[model samples]
Target: MTRVLRAGVAGAGVFGGYHANKYKQASDIDFVGIYDLDIERAQTAATAHGVAAFDDLDAFLSSIDVLTIATPAFAHAAVALAALEKGIHVYTEKPLAVTSRDGEAMVAMAAEKGLVLACGHQERAVFEAMGLYDVPEKPLRLEAVRNGTASTRNLDVSVVLDLMIHDLDLAISLAGCEAGGLQATGRRREDEGYSAVGGDEVNAEVDFENGMKAVFRASRMAAERERTMRIVYPSGTVFIDLLNRKFENGTPFALNSDFAEADIARDPLGTSVFRFLDTVLGVRDRPLCTGAEALQALELGFAIDEDVAF
Candidate 1:
C-alpha cells in the first residue's frame, strides 16, 4: 500500500478550515495538523478534523510533507517561502503574492528546491469542464463580472485582488496570451468599514497582443452576488454562469436551446489537494495551477491596480 502523505494547514480561518477538511477527507493524504497565529482557532479546526494543533510554526513545519497556506494574501509569500525553504511542498491560496517581486522570488525558491508549488485558482476546473482549456482561437471579446455583498473575509485587499483575480486568471488561461496591456477604473467607499484598502468596485479592460480584449468587473458592495463570464470567438460563444453553475454555448448567437449540465461540482480545494498528492506519488504530470501560471494572474492583478485610481 502507498503511504499516505501527511499534510499540515497553516491557517484556521474560513479558507484554512476548508483546506483542513479537504485534507481529512482525501484518501491519499493524512491530515497531520493545523497551525495559526490564533491558538484557539487552530485548536478548534484541528479538533474538528481529529488532528493535532500546533502553535509553533517550526514544529508544525517539521511534521508534514506538504503545507497548505490559507492565510491572507499579504502574508502568503512570507509563510510559503518559509515552508519552501524547508523543502516542504506548498499549496497556497490565490493572489499568490501581494506583488510580482514576491511572487517571482517564491517561484524561484520552489524551482531551486524542486518542490511542487500550486495555487488555489480552482476556477480552472470550471474552464476544463467548459472545454476552454484547449485554448480556443483568438477571442474577439470577453466579458466577465464577479460581484458579491461585503463579506468579512479577505477584505484586506481591493476587490481587484479579492474577487476580480479569479476572472483575470480564467481570462488569461482561456485567452492563452500574455497580459500585454490593460486600463482600469475603480471606486472606494470609506464608510463601508473596510474601504481603507481601496474601493468596493473595479472595472477594467485588458488587451492582449493577439488582438483579444477582455472586460472585467468586480464589486464587494453589490446588492446581489453575481459571477458570470461570456467569451466570444470567431465561430461561437461560450457563457458560464458561475453563480448558478450553468454553461451555455451559442453559435451564431442563438437562443432558446436547452443548455447541458456540466456537473463539475467536485470541491475544487479537495480536488486540488488530491492532485497535489498525485504529484507526490508520481501519478500526475503537474499541478493544476503551476507557479508560473499563478504569477501571471498576480501580475495582471497588480497591473489592474496600478492602472486604476480610486
Candidate 2:
C-alpha cells in the first residue's frame, strides 16, 4: 500500500488558500493544516477546509512532510529554507525568490537534503496540454503580453517578477537555452503612490544563446487584464490567447487543438501541486516546473528589471 504524506501550506493569502484546497483534494496528501504569521488569517483559511491553523512556525514545520510556500513573493526563500531545513519537500510559487542568491540557497539545500524543490510556474502544464514542448523546431522569435489592473496584491515586487516572470519561464523553456542578453524599458508609479520595486510596467526583449529572441510586455497598471503570446518557428507561427483559452496553431506539429478541454490546462494549479506530490512520492521524476527552471526565470526577471530604463 502507498503511504500518505502530511501536506501543509505556509501562508493564508489567496494563493495559499488555492494550495490548501489542492492539498485537501489530493488523495495522497493528508491535508494537514496552514501556517501564517497572522493567526486570524490562517484560522480563516484553515476553517474553510476544516484543518488546523498554526501561528507558530516551528510547530507547523514539524507536522508536515511536505510544504507549499505560497507566501508573499518576498518571503518565499525564508519560508522555503525553514521547511527544507526540516527535511521537508517544498513547492514554492513562481519567481522562487526575489534574489538569485536566495533561490540558489533553496535549491542547494533541497539537493543536499534529497528533497524535491518545485516551483509554481503552472503554465508549463498548460504548454504541455497544448503540445508546445513536443514541437521539433525551436522558436526563432516570440512575443508575450501580460497585463492586469492595479491591485494591492503582490505589490512587494515589481511587475517584472509579479507578471513578466511567467512569460520569461515560458520563453526560456521554449527556447531551451540560457538567455544571452536582454534590454528593457519601464516606468515607476511613484507619483501615484504605488510601492512596486524596480518598476510597475516593463517591456523587454531577451536574446537566447541558441539564437532565439523573445519579447515580453507586462503591466500591473493596465485598464484590463490581458494575456497572450505568439511563437514564430522556422516552419510556422502559433498564437495563443491565454485569457480566452484558445489558440491559432499554424505549426505543422500535431498540437492539441482542444487543449482548453484538457484536465491539466483547465486546472494548472491542481496539476502543478499534484505533480509536486507525485514527485515527492517517487511516482514522477520531476514537477512541471523545477527549482532550476524557476531560478533561471528569476534571474532573467531580475536582469530585465535591472536593465529597465525607468
Candidate 3:
C-alpha cells in the first residue's frame, strides 16, 4: 500500500485556499493544516476546511510531510528552504521566487535533500491536453499576450513575474533551449496610485538558442482580461485563445480538438497538486513543473525586468 502523505499549505490567501482544497480532496493525502504569519487569516482558512491553523512557521513545518507554498512571491524561497531542510517535499506557486538567486537556492536544496520540489506552472497541463509537446517540429516564432484588469493581488512583484512568467515558461518549454538574448520595455502604474509597485506592463522579445524568437506582452492595467498565444512552426501556425480554452491548429500534427474537455486542462491546479502528491508517493517521476524548470522561467522573468529600457 502506498503511504499517505501529510500535506499542508503555507499560506491563507486565495491561492493557498485553492491548494488546501486540493489537499483535502486527495485520497492519499492527509490534509494537515494551514500556516500563515497572520494567525487570524490562517485560522479562517483552516476553520473553513476543518483543519488546524498554525501561526508558528516551525510548528507548521514539523507537522507536514509535504508543503505547498502559496506564500507571497518574496517568501517562497525562505518557506521552501525551511521545509526542504526538514526533509519535506515542497511545491511552490509560480515564478518560484522573486529573484533567481533565491530560486537557485531552493532548487539546489531540494536536489541536495533528494526531495521533490514542484512549481505551480499549471498551464503546462493545457499544453499536455492539446498534445503540443508531442510535435517534433520546434516553433520558429511564438507570441503570447496576457493582460489583466486592475487588481491588488500580487503587487509585491512586477507584471513580468506575475503575468508574463507563465508565457515565458511555455515559450521556454516549447523552444526546449536556453535563451540567447532578450530585449524588453515596460511601464509601472505606481504613479497612477494603482497600488502595484513594479512594472505594470511589459513587452519582451527573447531569442532562444534553438533559433526560436519569442515575444511576450503582459499588462496588469488592462481594460479587459486577455490570454492568447500564437505559435509559428516550420509547417504552419497555431493560434490559441488561452482565456477561452480554444485553439486553431494549422500544424500537420494531430492536436486534440476537444482539449478543453480534458480534465487536465479543465482543472490544471488540481492536476498539478495531484501530480506533486503522486511524485512524492513514488507513483510518478516528476510533477507538472519541477524546480529546475520553474527556476528557468524565473531567470527569464528576471532578465526581462532587468533588460527593460523604460
Question: How high is the CA lDDT of each candidate model?
Answer: 0.83, 0.92, 0.93
lDDT of 2 by residue, 26-104 (tens): 9977988999999999999999999999999999999999999989989999999999999999999987999989999
Off by over 4 Å in 3: 190-192
Q: Write one digit per residue (lDDT tens) for candidate 3, span 1-310.
A: 8698998999899999999989988997889899999999999999999999999999999999999999999899999999999999999998799877889999999999899999999999999999999999999999999999888899999999999999999998999989989889988775554576468999999999999999999999899999999999999999999999999999899999899999999999999999999999988999999999999999998888889843
Per the 3 Å backbone cut-off, how many clashing residue pairs does candidate 1 have?
2
Model 2 CA lDDT for position 80: 94
For every model shown, the clashing-pair count is: 2, 0, 0
- Evaluate model 2: give its lDDT: 0.92
Instruction: Specify the poorest-scoring 10-residue window by lDDT in model 1.
Output: 255-264
lDDT of 1 by residue, 1-310 (tens): 8877889999888889888877877787878899998899989988988999888889999898898999888889998998999999999998899889999999999999999999988877666755666544667889999999867777777788889999988888877889787889988766644444666799999998788899999998899999999989898887888888777777544432222243334465666677877786778988778878999988888888888865
Measure candidate 1: CA RMSD.
2.6
Every model: Cα RMSD to truth: 2.6, 1.0, 1.0
**lDDT of model 1 at residue 238?**
78
Judging by lDDT, tell me the better candidate of 1 and 3. Answer: 3
